[model samples]
Target chain A: MKKQTCSRILPLVALLWGVGLCACGDSAPELQRYELRLQGTTSRFSTTYLSATAVQVTLGGAPLRTELLPSSQRMNVANATHAHLVAHFWLRPEQVREGALEATVVLDDFGAFEGTDGSAGFVDAREAPLRLKLQGDALERNGRAVIHIDLDRSIGAERQGSRPLLPHLRLVY
Target chain B: MRLKRQWLLLSLLVPSLAAAHDLECEVSINEQSTLVVREYPATLTFRQVVRNIHPTLPSTLQEATDPLLEPLGWSFTPPPPVAIPVNDSRTYEFSVTVESLEDCARIGQVPPSESVEFTDTLQIGWDQGMATCSARVQCVPADTFVCDDTLYVSSSAGTSTELMPLDPTTLATTPVSSSTGFGYDAMGLSHIDGYLYAISNRNLSGDPIPHVVRVDRVGNIEDLGSLPELAGQEWIVGTIMEDGSYVIGSFLGSQWLRLNPVTLEVLGQGTLPTTTPTAWAANPLDNKIYGYQSYLARMSVFDPYTGDFTVFGPVLGNVGIQPCSCAFQQDGTFLLYCYTSDPTVDALFEVDLVNGVATLLGSTPSLAAGDMASCAFPPAQGATPAVRPSGYYMIHEAALERCLASGPVKLGLLPAVVTKEDALRLLWSSPAFTLGGEHRSEEQAARHALARQTLTGVCNQRLFGGTPELQRLLLDTTTTLGRTRAMSRLERHLGEANGRGLDVALPFSLRGRATPSHALEQLQPRSSP
Candidate 1:
């Protein structure tokens, strides 16, 4: 009889605790999403080069997440208009000071690393910090980054005699 | 000597009117007449002339051969009709025919006979005179290899099992050999070492047995007997590899059976990466077997040694959807001939290896059930043939690599974060189903099938479309255990990728139970590995 009474009270106590946690939902962190696109330069980023390029999102120079776009997001890299990598990170209400967050999107194009026996790393430039402001749960940024770098035509480089360029990754959030 | 004595006695007995009349005669046989007993039943003719040099002596000539010529079947037709008038010569010809193997061998004996002689008797007004003529006999042997550059085809649609040589330029065909009493369903017509080899489903006795047959140029056939490995399979694809090993494959299954070219013995049998196409021809340029899927409108290259298949993207033209044939053109271009289901739509196409486009060359003869073979090298003509780089294999390999890198994810093998680990685990497993453990093998087979499905999917995407069975294979998931849940979502994504365009949702782990602490913990940087 005593064990049965304890089980009955345990459910009531657990229900009250779940309610208390739900009541403090205002302090919960919400995921902020952003779409990253590559612009500038005459180079066409083929599926192979796009797949080989590693995209990393860092907060205060600390790496938050790293992903290969095609493998991670299943984006159509060959389609120029649809070519873009999506990144996500969670930030608390208090952490969104001044209604903006400064994050650096690093794109490492490994086009030049090809034929280096996997011994070579990134061959091109990294982007500066891009400022992002929250519009609900999504991050919005104005203007795209314009950077000068080598061309990347990895797909037809051999057949077309297109030279392998040190493909630069541009950040447009 | 006895014949000469008889003639002298005849002259002595004839002593009528013992007046001696001047009589001169000469018997001559053409010395340049040669006999070559090449492939039996040979006949050699010898021309003989009897001259009457005595101005008034008219004579009738009688000829007798040496005893050695009796066994050689030497005989005169119409008794030679040797009657010579004054100052004239009577010339007659006789043939020596060799019928059996023994006689042919004797005719070709070493140190050819120098004493093979024939004697002639002349009757001049009851006064007999004799003269003799001698000649040498020489017979050379036949050649073992008869080289031909004619293109050949063995079709299953015709009623005759006779193989035909096809003129690639005009699409004309002439029977290379008489029907060997086998059915016309013989496939895999390949040329190897001056002879045409093919796989016939029916034997000479009309038995439904698959056998290897070698046919010489002049209609003689050497049946190499039944192949036990390919005993029951029908419509087997066959070709000789660059290394000269015979490759027998199946249209429905992936079995690649290699046989020794000379012995017709099994060299090796392994599973191919894909099922054999309807028709196959080895490219002399690369020594790889090229196959065409008339239904799918795609061309694929198969490496016999490596057992790898690199399927080129589908052709971009109106290549027929019926049974067709393929051979390398004289100039080393990929040639295709197809007789469509419509009786009048016979067409030939030249496929561009790099672009995967089929250009219509012209209409072809009725090749509804045709498969072709040719010598890799163009016909021996003026100078050494300069072969430019086809670069076909390189294009195929590049397409295969591209498909492998993106096809799986594009086909929803790894659509979401939850199924990524499982999909990758299954993708990395062995494709062979013959592994020992049952459960493990089933899992491996599932992975293998998925990998194949992915390969077909990517190649099909690059192509116009493909066989229903290929599409069914790509969509089939009954055996992929626990994947039913993921398949529905995969189908949605596939539709999105195929027609609806871009996918709006990202593949992430945010939907399920996520606390603020868990979310913040993901953002925190960890120590470098």
Candidate 2:
């Protein structure tokens, strides 16, 4: 009688334990989301650097800083991962051109990792150029970033088939 | 035994003409006082093949015809008057009227005293080339450790791939797409426009690639049909052509058939020039197809354009060359590899396309060279002939690396050279019930009963020539065991031993103390038991 009683109660305890194990496996970890807004400027290399020496860049609305672009670029933002950093930038110019700026947003660390392969810690970039344009007095999106490229440009100097050079901006943790 | 008996007769006559034994030719006295020269009967074969092309009599012919005598030169008279009696296809007798032996010599008629003018009767409609098969090998990729799927492999050292299309710094492989139906083989690359091809030996009313299987560039599978000849023959193999056609190796006899790749339609079928080559080499060294007849060990070099063969070789005895495979190169030579199960050794042989002479360049490390695939390449210095694989091999497939939300997921594969990651690989389906496993195009298959299949290179099963009754019995046995859940004991009781007292009802069982073996002795059939 005792053995039977013990056997009957053992199954009940086992079921309870199994339920708790299931809950623990599905528990969620704390997650935090962050975002980085990137801003940049652009200008025609020939028109802007004619009588000048170097270009400059600035974060937010801070003081202007020198910047440089690297070659061997993957030409894409997402594929740039695992690529070596080309070089360091230097601020060389005191004189500034008006309206030569652009902006973009990015999330650094999503706080928590989840799902298979921790892909839960990723983000998908839907923007094609994530680029910008620069103008005197106002920094704007450049290279037909807003409108379709086939529509033809209206503002910059009337050029045959060249797009104005754009600056770089990155958001990192 | 027939061959031995014939050889015995020759040996018995050898003492009369010691030097004549060295001369084996087909010369006869002609009525024009000249000598008539002919090509003698010889055994031609391919490498990796362990059999010989069997010669049957006129009864084996579809319409019962006599064998044709190939005339090579003329001697003694202007060739005797030929007489193949209309209603009788039995014998071929020529009325010779030779004036003098000197006149015959001028026509290259070797006298029977100094040389031999042998006479032989062989079956027509089939090739008489003899050959031996060799082991397989792996070679390519000048230098690399990465894996890649290659498109075609030439007998020479030329490989094609699309590894580095954009960047010159990384793998520089040109993209080779099969979307155009362009295929690679032991011959050069070929393709056809406006048609899909199927290969088979299915023997189906009209199914192509039935017994054999095929895997396309993207790994799509198809079945080829079987043949009607060589009843129950199996292990059919073949390749594709430029005009959406395929040259398939038949199962019953040592011959090749030109068929549609998409529909299993037969355009034409022909035999090889010479039946033999060095080890592991098949013939018909046409622009596209070269195959080895498994049982006959004969290699057929087919020229689909002309529907003819140019040369044949004698059988490769023990110390002779084994023709296993032939991979066409851009130049004149083709990469011919040898495979053997005896020692599990495989080698790469550089075979001269025109001459049919093979030279062993190097060998591959022991592996499963029984059946393999590699991307063909153009010839290179020092690598002009068959180059041995350098250490490791590449991945035998074209693994398309895809970056998913998960890790890198590889899917589609393209043609690439072989190395550590790109070992030569083969793509094919199954031929459990298919035919030649290769068909022509839809237009071709639409005409034949066995169309729409591809002749796969799986020549191991006896699909068409096995005992169906036994197979049915086996199936029934399997089903019965499944139902009863008892499979340990299974035997066929072909009624009890009739002479063994049936059920042992007689006192002392009729024979009194007869043993089981003795009891059945009386029931044994007079002939086979």
Candidate 3:
């Protein structure tokens, strides 16, 4: 009788163990990871005091990262893919009167993301120089200007890229 | 062996069961913004929405995490860890108390700039993750120390000998014990060094004497002594100076006597420019005494150093009220309490020191003529000495520099130009020139030279041209001097110039004329002339 009981119990235990292994396999899998970074460089010859208003990172025309005044110092893009970064600045009146002009370019946004299977991610490795060129006289102008820094070009550069690729910043006003 | 295996299985099952049901909470506060006075507590209500995210198993909501709000003097009652049902949400409320202003500063929650919004966060935690809620608290410094700044009024009409304390802000009255044996008429009352000094009719002869007495806040009067020099003076107005001395002004002789605050003895004596000074107060901003002359209905500023009194202009309001009393605010603004016979108006006014314009604040409790005195608990520690610009040009230049340094320029809002005529009027009305005897002419000539220099400097800066600043300056000058004809002419010229987008200039012919006309003439462009 004891031999018969043991035989029945062994098969039941084996079935239970098989079911437990299947349940463990059905749990959610871990996510993947990717990196997106931006860097900006101001023109060495530029002497305009720049007050930035907006900094944003867009993925396929959709914003992945955005910051408004007065918190426009930095932006963080989460789960970013196919992203491009841009910043907006203005020439204030006091800057004109004081005759102390200067321009600042900021790598406003940085992001880390996990790519889905077969999805396109940030792949460019070449560090290209994004130039800021000033057109009009900043001291005589009063309006807005924009700086578009290519994420692929800013990948390997330092977070605060101070080296100027152009001679002057482009002032719309 | 079997028991050990069972115990191991039970331990694993227990943890899994506990982890299955987790709490999800969202915390919020009732008021987003509050203004708290120091040492005064303000209430804050916190509402927390707690939900059980478990699929099937029911779990009890346990204790929440510390909100870390102790630094702000915020405390909560009914310590957390209340139970919640599975797949259902429950709202929990808690009270937060802010103790003092010092704690508000320590918390570093106040905004740096005016109109800038600030938020203080409170974190509430459950079995799972934490949720944070924030409230904006704007802590304002309260005048909590103004308990001693009561307005003391003693009735001169009726037999009611009580010195009543009136709330300076509200004009509410509190009754005190009777001053039975003290005196009938209290002429002037001033609080100095925790005691109230009154110039009352408390002499042995029962005459209107300038007998000074010490009165406590509770209306207990103590006879200090009598001023022998002012023994028989009537209708005397007394003011306390910043140096703790009493300046008693007598209406009979038009004399001002400086008396020792403690002994009530005359320290020095001088004559006033005007005959009767009905109201007077020492301006803490400039340390100068200011008074209203009842006879002339003029506002005068007295320089204690030079013993010079300068009359600015006619007092703004109806000055028919006899025995009006004036007191100075910490900001140098004067408060005038007066009783008018016509319609029996007992009104309190806030006087603008710059223009002597009295803005009616409200009516007092009684319409009867009474002696008014004011005291503040935490007395004003006198602000930075304000230099009264001698002439209009000096004032204009200072205002211009301040406007430039502050922000964007608004040319139309520039200060009015102090013309030579305005300076002369101010100088001629001064006691130094009017009462200086034989030296008046010499002083006048010197002042005239100084005025010319100021005007020349201003003209060199292109401030006299057809600019918006000049137009506004001319309008203000005409309005202040009551130059009706000149004001009408200038207004017409200005309107025409503004319509054509042209600037106006002050004509050279009208430079030094009293009631100057042709002050605003259309300026030809520099390209033309």
Candidate 4:
């Protein structure tokens, strides 16, 4: 009679432990936050350099300033040496309208790169159409988006001397 | 021998009193464009330069001669006493008016043959001596207005595209009633004979046939049929001549055609020196067609009679951006509206034809980037009538003082004795009461009040001191036009009263002293004693 009682108590202990483990696995997943990165290549003949760039993010035509990660950056002449830039951003669930955000990036006083050698300067890239449509859900879920840009494909090839290649962007989530 | 020497000395002294001094006087009249049948306030500026040669004594200007300029009524206020120090010079500036210069030119004996030069003699007396100076003035009458100066602008955006009238002064816009249903891109616009004429490339059917149409003030449009040679031509610049004819030019070619504004019939055809004229307007001052070449950005003046073109140097402004339309102000300055890459932003420039410079007036927003047309209506003819004011009509403190001493100051229904305080109160309330709007600031009001007070004291002492008829006119209450109307009438009348002669009536003391004896005689006849 003592051996039979031991066997029934062991099975009951095992069943309680299994139920506790399942409850831990069924809890909600952790909330995600996102950051964006831009990577590009430069052309050898390109002399155009960006001094400062202003980035504006809008959700359905209204400007959104709060969630912009690293809102502004001073490029100076160091942009020519730096091949990559990282900009982090986050958006509230209510702020995302129609599941997208429009980004307009403008280069202020984008003129010729003054080389260390002190050569003649080239013309300025006064205005460039650098607009991007960002996915709201991916930025909210993944916590990171990496963009790849090709400088040659973006800018126009109108000038003969010291022409700057346009940059392209790619997203990796 | 002693008597002869004394007589010779007397002759020398007498001649010295009448001898001319080192003083010079000059008079000039503002130039005008044409002679009209109305009275224009032609400003005659008199400048006197006095050189005092007396080493120890300063020269004092005693009096100046008042010349009678008939036909053109002469009126001038006596200049203030000017003093020249020994061995120094002083200049006295006096402004006078020649009323009805146009009528004077048409009816005068010598009738202004060349540039309308009129000469009059002026004699000035100093404390120690006197001098006579000749005042020669050159004046040309300006062209009178043919119509009201209303600016018209056209739109081509949608079905609501229509012609609208814009106030030349205020830029206030109002839609023309007949601007509906006639949907086409207006390439050019002009006004003649109280009607608005427009040239459009697309007909009502949206075809590529160029047509000229007349639109009335109520927006009723009358199609004048297709332009013969201008079919399919997109860009056109045009202006209305003073004789009611239209000068239209094609941007795609060098051909310019003159047409009867009413018939749309091509009366004459000529070639523009430049290939593409982006904007053009008729300069009534010189009766030449002035325009801008789009390619060269140069100013070109085209003489319609000689068919000759005078191309000026390149205009200095925004490079490569051409004006979509241009119109002339009444003063012959060109107003240009230029096109920009951004559809919403447009630039307006005032081009000085004489100086060859373009000054940016301002920028207008929400205007489409394309070839827009504009036309300015001629200035309104006989709009401002010259009505001279009597002494009572002048509302300043000087007039008020004279009127107060004479009788009750009746301004509308409320008649009261006007004082200096009342004059100041009237001046303080002028912005609201006289101008009918809030057009003056507190600072401006204070400044105007101070100026009026100072002028009143000076003018009253000079004009109302010795005049009986003027005093009677100053106190008359029959000419009062109530309160509201009286302010405006008095304001205009006060403008005319400036620079008028102070000899309208004899001394009030002379008349009053004479009248008391007559009063005594009448009383003696009635008295029983």
DockQ for every model comes to 0.00, 0.00, 0.01, 0.00
Sort the candidates on lDDT, descending order: 4, 1, 3, 2
Model 3 Cα lDDT, one tens digit per residue, B1-529: 9999999999999767646646654444453222223334556565656566667766555444323355444443335565556678766566666544433444434422111123443444444333333334444432221324456666654333566765557776776646755553333333224455666655444555456766654454555656567665664576666655667776677877776555444556888766756777777677677777766667778866578888787556565535577776655667877776545557677778776677777775454455666542124222111111122222233333332333332112222334333332322222112211212344342333233222222342233233222233333333332343433343333322221211112234322311111111111122110
Backbone Cα, N, C clashes tallied per candidate? 0, 209, 16, 17
lDDT (Cα, 0-100) at B215 in candidate 1: 58
Tens digit of per-residue lDDT, candidate 3, span A13-99: 344323232212323221111111222332211111111222333322222222333222212222123122333333223323333
lDDT: the better of candidates 2 and 3: 3
Mark the 10 consecutive residues where model 1 chain B has the least summed lDDT. Answer: B385-394
Q: Relative to the unseen true structure, what is the C-alpha lDDT of residue B348 in candidate 2, on a scale of 0 to 100?
A: 56
Question: Candidate 4 at residue B380, lDDT?
Answer: 22
Name the candidate that leads on DockQ: 3
Candidate number that wins on TM-score, 1 or 4: 1
lDDT of 4 by residue, B1-529 (tens): 9999999999998645533232333332232111122234555555545556655656665555534242344432335366666677655555555554333444333342212434443444454234433333434334321354455666654333565654445545565553444544433344333445566555555656667766544454556667666664653677776655677777666777777654354657877666756777777677688887766777788876678888896655562455566777656767766666566766667777877787777666634323333434443232221111121112233344544564433343323325544433332222211222223444443333223322332334344442222222233223433344443443322322321222133344422211111111222111111
TM-score of chain A for the candidates in order shown: 0.38, 0.19, 0.26, 0.52
Give the C-alpha miss distance for residue B145 in model 1, angstroms. Answer: 8.9
Error of model 4, residue A33, in angstroms: 99
TM-score of only chain B in every candidate structure: 0.46, 0.30, 0.41, 0.41
Q: Which 10-residue window in model 3 chain B sums to the lowest lDDT?
A: B514-523
lDDT score, candidate 4, position B469: 21
lDDT of 1 by residue, A1-173 (tens): 55555455444434432323322233332333344453323334332222122345444443433332332222223334443443444433333343323333333211112221212111211111122212222232322222212233212123111122222222222
What is the alpha-carbon lDDT of model 1 when measured against the actual structure? 0.43
